[model samples]
Target: MDSRFVGIADLVETPSVAVVVDVMRACTVAAWAFAQGAERIVLAESLDEALALKARHPDWAALKDGPLAPGFDMVNSPGLLRSIDLAGRTVVQKTTAGTVGALAVKGASLVLCAGFVVAEATARLLRTHECDSVTFVVTGEDGQADEDLACAQYIARRATGAGTDASEFLGRAAASRAATELATGVRQGVHPDDVALCLELDRFPFAMVATSEGPQMVLRPCAATSPTDAASI
Candidate 1:
């Protein structure tokens, strides 16, 4: 089996499995949410859709662009989820890069969200499912984000039976211009701790797979213990 790394702009054909990476925050947040017992994560491509979903399911947490809304449980920050109990809850999330990149790879046989937290689990799932080919899509900021690219390469290495030292990748990400800016300044709603969370490799034991339920795309645990429990999560 072989895996290829590509940027969002170069995603022309979907492979057997498409692992989407947005390590700056989005995918990392999703991974932590699942680990903290989030029932399911529904991805919305736009703020309008996310708000509409939240309106229909008021109990569900909604995360959109910009600051955390007054009524929403939290924004797209892993640090915020640390103290929150997402147990048996469904969360609706909208992000600038991750979810959008996920929706773009609609042709994939399997769509899985990837970050440091779920990297090992993702590789295990890929091997267990025997995917002949895989595509790692780095959902960079506007173009190519170093963090996303590093995460993609790490996953690629792991999936191919090559051992991964996440520290190297994390070092690259931390030194990136995007990370440097975030660390040096106090971005109003952005938290530096969230960046730290994104770099924590293999923190969770499960991988998040995107599945279509009716017209919506939802993320659920892809482990053998609850393979068919998409509705439950």
Candidate 2:
């Protein structure tokens, strides 16, 4: 299958598979939630929609970040997801980039969220399917370079059988604005551990794919065993 690294504006025309990336944090948090056995994750486009979903399903956990309303169960932090026991609980997430990008794609039959944590496994899952082309959606770009672009570049390379080894990509991500802010205590409500977790390559042996149920975009994991797999750092 062919692979192309594109921004969210190109979301309209995707092939059989589209992997949305927000490696700075959103997809990282979602990956950890799945790793901790979340039943399924819902992506909400707005705070009101997320609150409405929460009102309907009171048992489900609601998470939000990036200037959303304050009723969410937790901030959308990967560090927070690390400590939660989310087994069988539905996760409703609202974020500026990741959730929005994941939900905006209308053409692809399958949409998977990508981060360094699940990079290789996501690529492996893509290979299992018979696709003519795949698009890696980089959500973090805002007229400038960002970590999500770095991640999408890496995943696209690996998905199209062009490369292996994540060191170079990881370095670029670590030096990106998001990682640097967290490392320097410039980004509030975020910890260094969260950025650290996001940079660890191939940490999860699964890919998080977004599927629609009615009007909601719910995410589920597709797992595979890896020789280099380690659950935690």
Candidate 3:
């Protein structure tokens, strides 16, 4: 099998599978939302698209570029979701990096979103799908973010059956520039708890896969194999 890593600035060639990583919150939040019983997630490319989605599904949660809107149930922060109940509801998400990266890799046979939460599941899925070539896409805001790169490396290593160390990977990601900024930006509405949550590796046992339906990118959970089964891959 062949695997390659591509940052936001680099153009990605469609491989057998495209694994998009956004460790600093966006993808992490999506995993948490699904684990919390969200029906499905609709990822939009822009704030206007998110708003239009909200207009169509008034009961669903809408998240744009900034803080939680008046009518929206939650923002992009995983910490914010801790206070809300998303059982059987849908979420419309638009972010500067994660969702955008997910939408960009349309040429791949499969597009999966990866974060610390779904790293193991992602690796198992690639092995199960028998993907000979995989592209790891890091959704960095300015060329490359440490957290995203770290997550990409971790997933690649795990998928390739290399020596895997979850603690070391999480430590590197937690100390990244993006993590530090979010942890210290409480006044800017960035919560330390949110950063903490994003740093937790393999918190969920499912991978988020994006499938195109008409003009929308729909995200759903893929049940992962057991840790023992994943390690044997």
Give TM per candidate.
0.91, 0.89, 0.90
The count of backbone overlaps in candidate 1 is 2
Give the Å shift of residue 201 in candidate 2.
Answer: 0.6
- List model 2 lDDT by residue over 1-233, tens digit each: 77777777765555567889898788999988887778788999888999999999999888887433466787777876788888888989988888888887745697889899999888777767655688778887651446887788787777766666778788889899888877787766675588889998988878877878897788777663331232331
Model 1, 50-129: lDDT tens per residue? 88888899989887645877656687778777778889889998988899888878667789898888888888777777
lDDT string for model 3 (54-120, tens) is 9898988887545766655567787777667777889998888999888888666788898987888
Q: Model 2 off-target regions past 4 Å?
A: 12-14, 66-69, 224-233
Report the Cα lDDT for residue 90, model 3. Answer: 90
The local lDDT score (0 to 100) that residue 51 gets in candidate 2 is 92
Give the C-alpha miss distance for residue 145 in model 2, angstroms: 3.7
Candidates' C-alpha lDDT: 0.79, 0.78, 0.79
Candidate 1 structure lDDT: 0.79
